[model samples]
Target: MRDLDETDVEILSLLATDARRPFSEIGERVGLSGPAVSDRVTRLEETGVIEGFTVDVDRTKLRGGVPVMVDVDLAVDAGADSDSEPLEAARERLRDANPVEHVFITAEGDLRFYARVEGRTVREWLSGTFEGVPVDDWTVTLVDEVEWTPSIDGVEFALTCAECSNTVDSEGETARIDGEVYHFCCSSCLSRFRDRYQRLEEGA
Candidate 1:
């Protein structure tokens, strides 16, 4: 991994809080010009420091109550002797599943792959979509609580509201509400923040 400098870390920190925040605003906060901030962000993206910008959607507000994390163990074909070949095949099949949010290949344990599923029920997530797929064993981990912290270069990011300048911390994994970014300490806070932000957006 490439080492990140102080300015790079600060840029990552700010972007994590609100991906949509203009480069000018980020530059103001970090004491750089808009173009300079833009250049840094571009470099980070190219170097893989900033992977991609994504909006965190609220699952509960949609159809599902809460998303479940599923660990799937696949029974590979005996003909496939090499580990890399089997693993790649498993990943390709799993990627076809619509409910699968993320998939990871592991090396240290008996379980070779893990995935996060978002659906109305665990059965629908597993049996309905992944029934015919060859799998030896599977495990489902329902996330009851999550506490997320934004860190860059071994330091936590400082969060502040764009409107109020209130300090905030990662309550959990982020979820998008409409189109704006909001930070919450918990699910309750998330709901409240969404409502307030929506109202503000409407008024403007």
Candidate 2:
């Protein structure tokens, strides 16, 4: 993989602010030619640093309801009943629930969802959504406004080894095998991964 530098970081920050910002404008700000900025962006995309650009739509204007953030704690005996849906299955169902703009899973395994809901029917919506989900308790908060600002300030970027999930650093290695790129923290892990992959392929 290509090593990221200060210029790359600045490019990312600029793009994060406005994905449609022209390359010439970005070049003027970053002291590079437009083609140089485009090349760097293409490389960033190839290295997976830049996922696809997205559009930010104001759902509140379209949905015409009060926006709310709901956090749900899973019950200890969640999905214990034989006839009840499994915990993951129930979570998947909630994720696919209508009108939910965003869903997040906290480190502690709690579920949080953002949606626009009718103020009076908030309770009804909660009960209906969590009826099949194994929820212990939940809290709903009214969101007055939403602001999204992505920055690379004070951030260190590193890729994880495809085999052992370790951070790849300057001393690490990257290989292209089977027409795809993979990173490794050490050569031994890379060899092991390749051998296991070969064995699996032969067995198949």
Candidate 3:
């Protein structure tokens, strides 16, 4: 695995500020050639450092509604063997529901989501949306405005091992199996993953 360097972080910062910035411009700032910058960017994509380029759209201007934030407390299912699956299912349902832009799970196992309410009060929207959902209680806040800024300052990049979920350091290795790249903290993990994958393929 390639260790993330200062140049990579600079390239990421540039891209985060403006995804449309030319590779040549980034190369100039990072003291690398255009092709070198392109190569590094491609490697970053392959290593999952760069997921994808996307635009930050102002949803309020596009939709006819009042933007609001909702915090939902979920009921724990005592009868269920595992609560994670149910929580995930509830989150998916909320995501698929209308006008929800961003969804997050808090450290205390509460759900917070941003949405735009149209033609209805916050109470009505909440009552209608959380009809069959496993919810205990909820609170809503009207959003007046929003400002989002993404930065890479003081960020540390560490890839996780595919087999053991350990952090991949300088001593780690990367493997490309069946056209998909995988990272490992050590050669033993890589070998074990390969063996298990081969066995699964043979069984299939």
Candidate 4:
């Protein structure tokens, strides 16, 4: 993996702020031709340096439910590693849990769970998801205030549709073209991707 130069960083900055920014406009500011900038951005996407482009939407304006946090400590069997059979089974159950947005495991093998409170209380989430699961102990805390889709570290989080450049959901359809996977959130995006791929292959 090659380290990004200043030019790459500048390109990322512009795109992160405005995923819809034209390549020509970016080139004008960054002192590069349209094609040059296009090639660099394509390379960045292909290399996974840039995940995807997204828009910032106010969660309060949305109709989704609030967030809740749950902490679960599973029972550890004697003479077993962290990835023991019981833990793996519990993990599988958690994956199928309703409204579970995120789950993180601590160094002590305890789980930190984040879930959506869609007409259900934090205790309800615990009862629904963690019930019947073998656990040493568990606790629930309602997140009174929180930030959804917070910025990653110091960088902005944005994911643009690779085909049409429209801001799309993180959980979208994906396709593998010539061993390179591309994300598409709609049929229009898939059509655009197919057309572009055909053109590129024909030209090649």
Candidate 5:
């Protein structure tokens, strides 16, 4: 994929703030015609860059409930490694757990599964769902608050030039690793970065 231009980055920034913003409104802000903006938006959607529009439903407002975060540590099969299929199976098991809203596999220590549970009392839901499960360990963190930002920490953004420190446009074709975002000036820089990282890993 080719790198994104300034206009594309602007469009992404606008969308990142409000996914449901209309093409006409976005076009007005970005100095593009409505149809032109729509075409770009359609292309982004088709290419999977814009996954889907979603609403952040306030679960707490429903029946006066509170949201809870559950950390589930799975006891993998004796032969199973971190990325083993059995780990996947264990994650699939949580699909039926009514309290689970989202699950993530963390690269952190032994803590494998992170589940977001929405219920009146997070502790009660976790106790009921985890009953009889052979969990290695678990931790619960109450989500005190959350804030959405245009850019994330640790995700590498492409540099404008190898010599310049300016951020490269990140409308599309940018790869995100861990939390760091990287933007390549060209294929050569991308190759160079990968080669250096590979050597570092080998040495380690």
Candidate 6:
């Protein structure tokens, strides 16, 4: 798959706002045609650039609770050659926990994970999970929210406007053609692409 550029970023941003938005509507906003926008979107999904769209369900309504970060300093056995075994085992245990949202390994050699907790399970997970071995220390801190979004900068693209040879910023504006999303610096270039696109369609 090709690298995602500014246009891809913009498309993702638009979708982020409204997942159900029509590709043609997104194209009009970004200066791309419906087919072109649709193609890029498909590419994004195929390449895993766009993981999967999700609905913003109200957690409180579903199951009320507080979100917290669990910081666990894994206790590797003294003189043990590797902690990988214990770490993986612990991760497997956490996987069964429905509250768990994300898990990550920090550079400082600790596991930082986020999960929602309610009633007594919070205390149980905080202690019972790492009781006998493996964890050196652990702490749970309540968090207001958890958001994980990534931005790819200056990602690879076709590089220039098909209309004016102007350099395109994937973040700027866009026009899609034959399923390819084209980025533009402004409306004028996008307009140029739009005009050419209509003619091409009419001719076709």
How much RMSD separates candidate 4 from the native structure?
A: 14.1
Q: Over the stretch 112-166, how does candidate 5's per-residue lDDT look in tens digits?
A: 3333445545667666665666566667777665432235596643335331233
Q: What lDDT does the true structure give each of the candidates? A: 0.58, 0.67, 0.69, 0.64, 0.54, 0.65
Q: State which candidate, 3 or 4, has the greater TM-score.
A: 4
Candidate 2 C-alpha error for residue 203, in Å: 42
In candidate 4, what are the lDDT values of residues 11-114, reduced to their tens digit?
76567658899999999977899999999988777776666665333232222445668777777767765546656666767666545656787787667877
What's the lDDT for residue 47 in model 3? 68
lDDT winner: 3
Mind giving the per-residue lDDT tens digits that candidate 6 earns over 16-82?
5578999999899778999999998887777655666642333332233567888877877778898
Q: lDDT tens string, model 3, 77-183?
A: 88988767657867767655645656888887667988767736778877777778777888788887765432368675667889868666543446667767787
The worst-scoring run of ten residues by lDDT in candidate 3 lies at 55-64
State the lDDT at 133 in candidate 3: 73
**TM-score of the candidate numbered 4?**
0.43
Ranking by TM-score, best first? 4, 6, 3, 2, 1, 5
Candidate 1 or 2, higher TM-score?
A: 2
Candidate 5 has what TM-score?
0.34
List clashing residue pairs in candidate 6: 6-170, 6-171, 7-170, 30-174, 31-174, 31-175, 32-175, 32-176, 33-176, 75-134
TM-score of 3: 0.41
Q: What is the lDDT of residue 96 in candidate 5?
A: 59
What candidate 6 gets wrong by more than 4 Å, as runs, is 1-64, 131-133, 153-204
The per-prediction CA RMSD against the true structure, in angstroms, equals 17.0, 14.4, 14.2, 14.1, 13.9, 16.5
Structure candidate 2, residue pairs in collision: none
TM-scores, one per candidate: 0.39, 0.39, 0.41, 0.43, 0.34, 0.42
